[model samples]
Target: MSTLFGLLRKKMLAPSLASVGFAERGFPVTPSAATVKLEAVPQAVVCGFEWAIEGASLWELERRLELVEPEQRGFAYEGATMGYTILDAMPGGGRNRTRELLEGPGKPHIFLTYIGIGFAMARLPRPLWKNILPELSGVPYHPTMSWLAVDGYGFDRAYFDTRRWVDEQLEPEPYPWAGHPGYFSRAFDQGVGRALWFIHGGDPRAVAEAAGRFPERRRPDLWSGIGLAATFAGGCDRAGLAELRQASGPHHDELALGVVFAVKARTFSSFVPRHTMTAAGILAGLTVEAARALADRTEVAPDFDAPEPPYEVWRDRIRADFSAGDQRRAG
Candidate 1:
């Protein structure tokens, strides 16, 4: 976003985005993953970083990013998938393609579509977000929702790419992956709930059912993702919010606490989106003073460093809090 107009647009939007709780700050360039390094990272992510640093406009960057075929099927693919989705809508529009992906045999890459919506989110504003998200009302908790992690990446990169928000970046480490047997890269799925929040327009009941559809072992993680998204983008009513928590069964508090911490941490960012304020309201249970207090508490946490591996840390923290009893209760 370093182009003259992109810079000007960012400058104009940064303060407003910050006010809404969206982080306009860019991520660092350091490779902090336990297993990877700069050169070893996914080519598109690294190349995207280089492209941004070199002042590629969104249009110019999309040339490579939007292409469906990848340079190489590196360890991580969502980053590149997100790049494609940002340039334009999905094939035959959002709803049709999403439905086909969901109802058809290929369930895995379905998350790719959701994350691709994040790219759309980067280019389009919240008012128009519905354009890319399509209405998947009765879609039953499709597993692609698990790819909500990709959606999170899309949101993170769309709103906070170092190239776009050049003022507050640091060195980044490698993007985290679940290693070896891969197992669908839950490491990458950290923000699945948040993206689900966006995909379902913050419908707590829908989010709950979606999480429930996952398996006994996966519910807590799914709920936590929902909590993150609810805090970041959900605008549920109190009753709906309560239902959201209720739907999570026993892990509701843990989910809310994680999302609260996430929202609180991001509040320190130099930029935010307009919906952030609404999300802050949801995080605070719809009270501004409470939200402020919530923010104040997280502002001083010991491990809250912008340059660290945020998504991974949050996941670890939530899982650490999750107990067998809690899991049973949730079940």
Candidate 2:
């Protein structure tokens, strides 16, 4: 039921499964069970993109998305959100598609859905960025968490153009996303940190090294991103997670903060895989329940009106708790 334009959009925008492989991206990840699993995550995203761009109805998309296993289902929804976001930005495309998805079945996966909006931003013009976020006023973390879209944008850029964003360490010019231009670059670096996980194929040492390569100030955000991806997307085992923790050095609290957020997201979606639980224990030194409690305890109100967005405040509270060694008792 796709229009000709929708078909063409799918053809042009949806990435091939093979393209997401580490080898395709010139990464040095060895062919292993872990690498294969990591690759499948993006492939799932691509599937969602194809389905959404092909004009799948909400019911149809939900059916297709539900077919994905629980652990990876949120990621597929991320891709579908991205596809719908892109469509919504196009000429003659109404903006309600993203709103409908997020307000309905996409609500559970709202965290990832915001990141999907970032993926769409990578493809759209700057002028179109304003219309990207829908009015989800009563949504739990709508405006504040929208920073994940910027994070997602950073992830997309680093993933697709490693030489420029990663190797060259080019800083993106700041834009006033969510009215805080100062924090934009930090959120972007968080996404770059997430990319480092994929770029290094979840090698704990390599990810640590990649993060260290950035300037000292940027390392905290980068480490935070790495923690989120490593825990949520999960390419490494417990020992590897321990190694990542060890390698984090002074940013260990920042890394643990990311783990807490990842746990919150997974728990919010009502699907915490064993790997996430393992990562929480190894990296954050807390059980999943404890991590979720820490996140909830530190969460800022949605209407937190200040120079800093509530998202950063929430992150800061968690980070501060980690620094004080208080997160372990959060549960």
Candidate 3:
């Protein structure tokens, strides 16, 4: 009965997309992953999700992020909401102001700051965001990327303070995970990848360079987040796509697999009104119909929108697609 219900949901999901104008106009995936001029991407690909942020920019929202009492800073989505709001205002004219804040006191909230900046990047005209990459090029990946563990603090802190979210780990993992140290860096890099997609202006080459800076073992999860942004937000060019494929190294499938997981997490949210068929279309290299079909084939029922167990399943599934020592190949 559970399987049948999930199958039905997945089936309905596709048609539901078509009903609300998430229709794929069959724009061919970029041939070489070169920068796809924003004008070239079919307007059909202009996800309506970004339209919401088009309103008046909330002033100093990022400033407020710093001000939020530590307890208040820990809510599940509020910090992100704050991040998006500040970026929406294009505070200090978007990246210019964020560039300063990236180094300023808001530095601690770098995870939320960059994530919100990514949200801003999704809305802005391209190349504007892409140029900022050079400013970040000199930075190291680990500590910079690991700051994302701060993004997990709300959940981990909640668990620790109230015993509320997940079973507390016996001791902290090296990186934060539901109050565990395990996978902390992975969590951090995932945020970095999501933000990197936007920072590179969806250029694959930039993404590759950014991902390249990370230690090799760390690249897969980072690529996974990049894939998520590239898919959910629809920016990477042919070269970017190819770079992602190549850079996935051993974790290529796992990286692409993140798109599937992110699609599920994001589509269920009110944040993406088109239900992400467009994102699915981008990642699967499919027309709307084909993308929908693929999702239906892989869809499963999970009580939580972003369940953890299947994340591992998708990760391992990608790994299994490769034999021992098989590396991801770029076209």
Most TM-score-accurate candidate: 2
> Per-residue lDDT of 217-312 in model 1, one digit per residue for the tens?
655555666676555433565566667666767766557554654454334322233444555454334343454354343232333464433334
Candidates' TM-scores?
0.39, 0.97, 0.41
What TM-score does candidate 1 get on C-alpha atoms?
0.39
Q: Distance from true position, residue 61, model 3, in Å?
A: 15
Ranked by TM-score from best down, the candidates are 2, 3, 1
Give me the candidate number with maximum lDDT: 2
After aligning candidate 2 to the native by TM-score, how far in Å is the CA of 262 from where it should be?
Answer: 0.4
Give residue 143's error in model 3 in angstroms: 26
Model 3 Cα lDDT, one tens digit per residue, 107-216: 44343344434333333444443342214322322123322333233222321232222123122235332333455545545655554554455666666776676667
Name the TM-score of candidate 2.
0.97
Write the number of the candidate with greater lDDT, choosing between 1 and 3. 1
Q: Is candidate 1 or candidate 3 better by TM-score?
A: 3
Candidate 2 clashes: the total is 0
**Global lDDT for candidate 3?**
0.41
- In model 3, the Cα lDDT at residue 85 comes to 34
lDDT of each: 0.42, 0.91, 0.41
Candidate 1 — number of clashing residue pairs?
28
